[model samples]
Target: MSSSSAPTSGTLTYDQAGVNYDLIDPLKVSAQRAAAATASHLASHGFTEVAASRGESAYVVDVGPFYIASIVECLGSKALVADEMATLTGRSWYDGIAQDTIAMAVNDLITVGATPLVVQAYWAAGGSDWFGDAQRAQSLVAGWKKACEVCNVAWGGGETPALAGIVEGGRIDLAASCTGLINPKERLSVGDRLQAGDAIVLLDSSGIHANGLSLARKLVERLPEGWLTEIDPVNHPGLTYGAALLAPTVLYSPVTEALWQAGIVPHYCANITGHGWRKLLRHPATLTYRIHTVPPVTPVLAFIQQHAQQDDREAYSTLNMGAGFALFMAPEDAQRTVEIAQGLGIGARIAGQVEAGPKQLLIEPLGIRFGDDDLQLR
Candidate 1:
C-alpha cells in the first residue's frame, strides 16, 4: 500500500469536498414544505396523499384500499470511481455501479414499508460516444437487470439521453426511480408508531455503500498512487482503493420484505445513506435514540478514517461507518428482526432503543451524539 503524509493542520471534511448538507438541507426543507401544498391536488384523482410521509424516504399516497410509495434516487459520484477503476484495472466495473444505482432507489423505497414493484432507470450520458463502448454498456445493462431481479422488481424501462455540453464529455450520470406497494394499508412505516421503547435494529453495510464518495474521491489526491493505492497490505493484499470503493451496495429490500412476510412491522425504518448515523434522528417524533453498540467498521472505511484524519464524531456524522439500515420496532421484535436479516444473509443486531426526550442520537460506545440540528431534512 502506498502512504501519504498526514494533513498539516485541519482534518478533511465533507464540506471541504463541496458536499455541504447545511447549505443543501434548507433547500430540502423548503421543497418539502412546498411539496406538501400540492398534496391536496391528489384528491381530484380520487387519491389522498399521506401527509405524514411528506419528509419520509418515499412519498406515499392512499388510493382507498392500498397505499403507494415512490422515490427517485441517484447513484451520486460513485460511478466516477468505477470509471477510474476501469481505466486502472482494464475491467469494467459498471455492473456493480448499476447495482449501486438500483440499490439507492429501492433501499429508500422500502423504508416506507413498501415492497418495490418496479424500477425505472435514467442514464444521461455526456455524449452518444459514451455508449459506443460495448463492454461497459452491456455490463451496465446486465447489472441493472440483475439488480431488478434481486429486488423482485420489474425493469419498467427508462430513458437514456445524450447531453453533449450539459454533462462532461465521456461521463454518464446514473439514477433510478422506484414505485412500491403498501398493501392492506397496514405496512406503512413513517415513524407514526415510533416511541420510547421501540428497539433499534441495525443492519451491517458492505463498506461505504455509496455515501460520502465526494469526500472519498477528494482524499485520493493526497495519495501517491491515487485510485491504485492498495487499501490494506496484509489482509486485503491486492485490493486497490478503486476496487473497494466500487464494491456494489448491499440491496436491502429483501430484508424489509422478509420481515413483513414474517408478520413483523417496524415502527420506523431508515435507509442510512447520505446523512450517515445522523439519519437515526430522521423521524419527526421527539425521541432520543440510545445506541448501545455499533457494527464493526468496514476495513476500507477504517483506511479512509486513518488517512483522512477524521475523528469519531466527524466520521460517524458523514459516513455510514458500518450500519446501512436501521429499524425501530417493538422491543419484543428486535431479535426477530435480526434473525430475519440474518436469514437473508444480512448481518444485523439490536443496537439500541428509543427514548422519550429531545430529538437526538446518542451512540454510547463512541460517546458520539448527534442533535436535531445535525439533520434538517424535514
Candidate 2:
C-alpha cells in the first residue's frame, strides 16, 4: 500500500497534531496588546514614527537621528529538549541551551536593522542540586561569553532563580533580552521602499533555527519504532541530531555588517521565525510576496514532510523552510548582496520578489496564497 493508504491506525486531532492554540492564543493576544500599548506610550512620550508602527520585531524608539530597538525572546519548548539532553548525553542541560537562548533574543533585534549592544538572560530552575547549580551557572556564563564574542556585543549580567516546587525534575528555563541601536536614517521598515521586482534574498538556516519544534516533536513521537535509532535517515547526522537541533542560533550580525559595508541597504528585513511570512506581513499594505525558489530543503525538513504528509503550505508556515533571514533589497542590489553574503562564507539565494497586491503572500510553484486573515496575529 502507498504511504497515505498504509493505515489510519490512530486519529490525529489538530491539537494532537501539535497545534494547541488554547495555550498559544492567550499569550499571543497579550503580546499584541502589550506591543500596541508600548507603541502608544512611545508616541505619547513625543517619539515620532515608531517602527512598531510597522511590526518587524520590536518597538523602535526614535532617538534624535538614531533608533533604539529592543527584543526579548525565550528559548521556548526547546528548553524541555535541552533538559532532556542532560539525561541523554550526560551533559549539563543549561550549557546545552544557553547559547540558543542568546541567539534567539539577538537575532530578532538585528531583524529590525539594529546592531545588538548587550544581552541579558533570565534563568529559572527547580530546587537546584549543588552539581546542577554549579553547572548551570558555569554554562550560562560560558555561553554568554561565546555569544558576545561572536556577535561583538557586551554580556550584561543575568538572573537565576531556584524555584522549589514550581518546576519539575530540576527543569531550567532560559530566556534572553537584547538591545540594539540603529541610526534612524538607516532603519529599514517593511514596504518602506519595497517595490515590484525587488529581489528576495534568503540566508541559509542552520537546521531548525529555534521555531516550530512543538510540531516537530509531535511528529517524532508519532514515528514508528526503529525510526529514531537509524542514522542519516533524516538526512542529518543521526548521532548529532539533538545537538544540531540545539545548535546555537546563528547570529546574523556578520551578514548585516557585510551588507552595510557593501552599501546594499535593504528596504525591508525579517528574521524568519515562528510564523514565517505571516510575521513579515505585519505591516498593513497591499503587497504580495512571490517566492519563486528556496534553498535546498535539509533532510530534517524533508523527513517531517514525508512522515507527517504535511502539505507545502503547512510545512512552510510552521517551519523556517531553510531560510533564516530574509532581505528585501532593490532589484539592482540583489546580486551585490548575494556576493557579499557569499564572501562571508554564508549561503544565499534569491527566494522571491515583491509585487503589487492586496497585501497577500502568493508562493508560486507551491500554489499557496495566504490571505489577510491567515497573516493576522491570532
Candidate 3:
C-alpha cells in the first residue's frame, strides 16, 4: 500500500484529483450534439432512433417490431485500487472489477426498459504479459460470465488488445458494452409517462459502487498506509480501504425485470452513477423531483466524507450516498416497486413524489435543491 507519491492535502476536491466535469462536460455536450445529427442515418437501415433516448443513459433504436438499447461503460480508475490491493494482499480483485464492468453497462441499458441480451468485454492492457497471470485472467472471465448470466444476458465475444503506447505497464483497463431488447415496446420507461403525481422509489447501493474512485484513490495518497488503512471498524469490521472500495456494484437489471413481470412499468428509471442523485432530474420533463428522504449513509462513504471534509451538498452531489437507483412511477405502484426490489433481496423504499414545478430535484431531508442547471448530462 506504500507509494512514492507525496501525502495529499487533508481537504480534497474531485476536480483537484484530476477529473474536472466542468472541463469534461462541454465536450460531452458537443459529442451529444454531433451524435444527434447522425440519428437520421439509422432510418435508412430499417431502424429509427427514439428521440427521447438521445440524452438518456442508453441509446434506444426501434427496428419495427422490437427496440434495442445499447450502452458502453468503463470500470474507471477503480481497477487501480485493485492493482494496489493485489500487491499488498497478494489476492487479485479483478473478479469484482469484472462484475463492476457488467453492472456499469447493463444498469444503464435496463433504464431504457430493455432486457440485456448480450454483453461484450473490452480489455486493453499496456503490456503483452498483463494476462500472463493465469489466476487473474480466469477470475475476470468467470466473473464477467457470471454477471451476464445473473442479468440473464449472454456473454458475447470481445477483444483484448495490447497497446504499447496507449496504456501503462502492469495495468489493464476494463470496459463493456451491452445490447438489450425491449419487445412489444409498451414496457419502455424513458420518462414518457412521468408526471407530477408519480412516486419516486429508491433502491439501496452496495457502498461506493463504480463512481468517485478517482477521488477515493487520491485520498489514499493522504492516508498513512494508503489502501491498507482499515476503514471504520464498526461498519467494515477488519476490512481495509481497498477491500471496501472494491465491493462489486449491484446489478439493477433483475429488479427492472421483476417490475416488468409484475406489470409495473416505471415512468422513468435512472441508474445512479457518476451524476449521483442529481440524476433524478435527468428526464426532459418540466416536473420537479421532490425527495422527502435521504437513505442512511454507508459507513465506508462516511469515512470518505469525514476524511475529505465534504459538506452534505458536496457529498450528495458526488457519491451515491446509499441510494443507487431511482424509479418514477404512478403513486399506486410505489409500494409494489419496493416489494419487488425487496423480494429480489434488494433494499428499497418510497422516497418521494414529483411536483409540478420546473425541472429540479429537492432533497427535503437535507434541504438541498438541484436545479436543471445543476445536472447538465446532455
Candidate 4:
C-alpha cells in the first residue's frame, strides 16, 4: 500500500524536527577516519582487523578460526516517549524500552551474519531516584532478560550510572553493545557477494523500530490529544498513539540464524534504522537498487506521515514506513528467505532487485529515487 502525500505547506521534515544528517554524517566520516588509524594497533594483540568492515554496521576482527563482530547502538529518543506515555497510560513500558535498546544493537550485529553471543546494557539516568519506582525498575530488568533470551544472547553485566547533570532527572538513557560470532568462516557478509540481479527481501517491522522517534515525538506535539490520541479511531479503537509508538522492535538475530541454518547466505544485509529506505543502498558499491514493491506501512507510521505533512520522499527518507530490514541475495534464494522468516512468524516479501548502474535507489511503486548523496554513513 502507498502512503498519501500531504501538501508542501508546513512540512515537518526530519531535519526540521531536530536531526540534521547533513551535520551528523560529517562526524561519522571523521570517526571512521580516526578509527582507521587505530586499526594497526590490533596486530599487537595477535589479531588482524578486517579493513573492509570498518564502515560496516558491525566491526569484524580476524581471530584465527572465526571472526568476532561487535556493534554499539542506542535507542535514541524513544525512551523519552516511553516516559511520557507511561505517565499518560498509567502503565510501565520499560519492558519494551529494554527490548528496543537490545534490538537496536543486536540487529546491527546480525547484518554481518554474526550470531549474537552477549549484549551489554548501558542505562544512564539523570539521578539515582529514577530507578526508585519498583514497578518500572523491575519491568526494565525483566524486559532486558526477555529480549536477551529472544536474541539468544547473554545479558552480560552493564553500567547504570546516575549522571545528575548530564541527563534529565525524570528520564533514563538506554543503549547497548553486542558481541557476536561468525563461525564456519563462510558466514560473513559485508556486501562482497552483492551483484546485479540479486533479489531484495524485506522483513516487516513492528511499528516504528527506535529510529525516527525524535521526529515522531515532534509530530505528537501537533496532535490535539497528544499521547492519548487514538491511532485509528474507526478501525483500531483503544490503540492509543503512545501504545503504538512504544511497540518493541523486532529482534532479527534469529531470522539471520535461520537463514544460515537453511544454507541461504544473503549477499548482503541491512538493518533499516536511522537512514530509512536509503539504507537499501548502504553497501559501498556502485549499483542501482530497484524496488518494485514496498511492505504495508503500519497505521502509526501512516498517521505520522499524514499528520506531519511529509511527502513521499520525506516520509520514505525518515521513517521505516514498514520494511525494517533488508536482505540481498540470489534471486533463487529470495523466496526461501521469505519462507524462512514466515516460518518464524515474521512478515517477509521479495521487494526489489539490484541492477548494474549508478549508486542510487529507485522505489518504482512510489516513484521516489534517492541518490548516493542522500546517505553518507561512510
Give the root-mean-square deviation of each candidate in angstroms. 2.9, 4.5, 2.1, 3.7
Pairs of colliding residues, candidate 4:
none
TM-score of each: 0.96, 0.86, 0.96, 0.96
Model 4 regions more than 4 Å off = 1-9
- Sort order, lDDT high to low: 1, 4, 3, 2
Worst 10 residues of 1 by lDDT: 1-10
lDDT of 4 by residue, 149-237 (tens): 88889998999999998998888989999999999779989889999999999999999989888778777777889898998999899
* Span of ten consecutive residues with least summed lDDT in model 2: 1-10
- Please write out the lDDT profile of model 3 over residues 1-378, one tens digit for every residue: 223343355567666667656778788888988999999999789789999998888999999888989989988988898898999998788889999999999989999899999999999998789989998898898888889878999998898999878888989889999998997699877878988999999999988999989878878877787788889877567888889999899999999998988988889999999868888888888998888977888777888888888887888888999998999999999998999999988899899999899888999999998898978776
Give lDDT: candidate 3, residue 96.
90
- Scored by CA lDDT, what does every candidate get? 0.90, 0.70, 0.87, 0.90
Off by over 4 Å in 2: 1-14, 17-19, 22-54, 93-96, 130-137, 224-228, 231-237
Pairwise TM-score winner, candidates 1 and 2:
1
For model 2, what is the alpha-carbon lDDT of residue 235?
A: 43
lDDT of 2 by residue, 1-378 (tens): 011222233432224445557788898888876756655555676776565434566557786778878877888877766665666777765554676787788877777778889888787776666236576568767877887787888878777777767755567667889988886456555346777777889888777767876655555555553223332544444544455466556677788877877777888787888876565565566777888887876556665565667677777776777778888889888888888888877789887898887777777867888878876653
| Number of the candidate with higher lDDT, 2 or 3 | 3
